[model samples]
Target: MAGGNFMGRVVSYVVNELLVNTLANSPAFQRFAVRTSKRIEDASNLAARKRQELQEQLNDSLRKFEDMSQKKH
Candidate 1:
C-alpha cells in the first residue's frame, strides 16, 4: 500500500509539471504575456509623462508667484 501511494504521488507530480510546462510554452500564453508586458510599459510611460507635465506647471506657477512678489516689493 505504501509503494502504491508513492507511485501515485510521483505520477501526479509528473503530470502536473508537464501540464504547467506545456501551458507556459504555448503560443497563446506567450502572446498574452507580451501584451501584458506592453500594456504595463505603456502605462508606466504615460504616468511619467503626466508627472513631467505637472512638474512643469508647478514650476511655471512658482515663477509667476515669485514675479508677483518681486513687483510688490
Candidate 2:
C-alpha cells in the first residue's frame, strides 16, 4: 500500500508539472501577459504625469511666497 501511494504521488506531480508547462506556452497566457504589461505601463505613465503636475504647482506657490516676502521689504 505504501509503494502504491508513493507511485501515485509521483504521477500526480508529473501530471501537474506537464499541465503547468503547457499552460505557460499557450496563446491565451501570452495574450494575458501582453495585456498585463500594457496596463502596468499605462499606470506608470499616469503617475509620472501627476508627479510632474504637482511639482509645477509647488514651484508656483514658492515663487508667489517669495514675491510676497520681497514686497514687504
Model 1, runs deviating above 4 Å: 1-20
Report how far residue 19 has shifted in candidate 2, in Å: 5.8
Quote the positional error of residue 30 for candidate 1 in Å.
Answer: 0.7
In model 2, what are the clashing residue pairs, if there are any? none
Provide the lowest-lDDT 10-residue window in model 2.
21-30
Model 1 / residue 72 / CA error / Å: 0.7
lDDT of 1 by residue, 4-67 (tens): 9999999999999999999898999899999999999999999999999999999999999999
Q: What's each prediction's TM-score?
A: 0.71, 0.68
Quality of model 2 by C-alpha lDDT: 0.98
Tens digits of per-residue lDDT for model 2, 1-73: 9999999999999999999999899999889989999999999999999999999999999999999999999
Query: What does candidate 1 score in Cα RMSD to the true structure?
Result: 4.5
